[model samples]
Target: MESGPAIFAGAAFTLFGAALLLWTGVRARQGEPVALGVAPRAAVALTTLFGACFLLLGIWCFGRL
Candidate 1:
């Protein structure tokens, strides 16, 4: 696959993950539930991991491009 598309897709994924993290934070501030059936700490860990993956992937793709 071309590095351009991969870079673009990776950037999109990273942004989406960032948006999710931001939403999660807003919900937490409002005293709302973070995730169904998941502990708050675990949910945060999962979110951080997910976002980190996207960020790293995007960086890698950008480097390749």
Candidate 2:
């Protein structure tokens, strides 16, 4: 349960989330569908999930430290 791993995870997740959001935005502007039968809501949900994971990891890491 070392804080190092949690911190790394947090950073990675945050970066991933940021990238996803950015990509989604670009795709949206291009008027491309993210997935078949999937709407903008789905993308928002995915972004939220990633953000939550990052937040949880960050809290865990800070708590450990």
- Model number with the top lDDT: 1
Best-performing candidate as measured by TM-score:
1
Q: Give the per-residue lDDT digits (tens) of candidate 1, residues 1-65.
A: 59769868778876877777787778778877778899987887787778677777767766776
- Candidate 1 stretches with Cα past 4 Å from truth are none
TM-score of each: 0.71, 0.58
Residue 18: error of model 2 in Å? 0.3
Error of 1 at 40 (Å): 1.6
lDDT (CA) per prediction: 0.77, 0.66
Cα lDDT for residue 53, candidate 1: 78
- For residues 1-65, write the lDDT of model 2, one tens digit per residue: 57778678767765766667676667767877755677776875676577566656655555666
Model 1 residue 24 lDDT score: 75
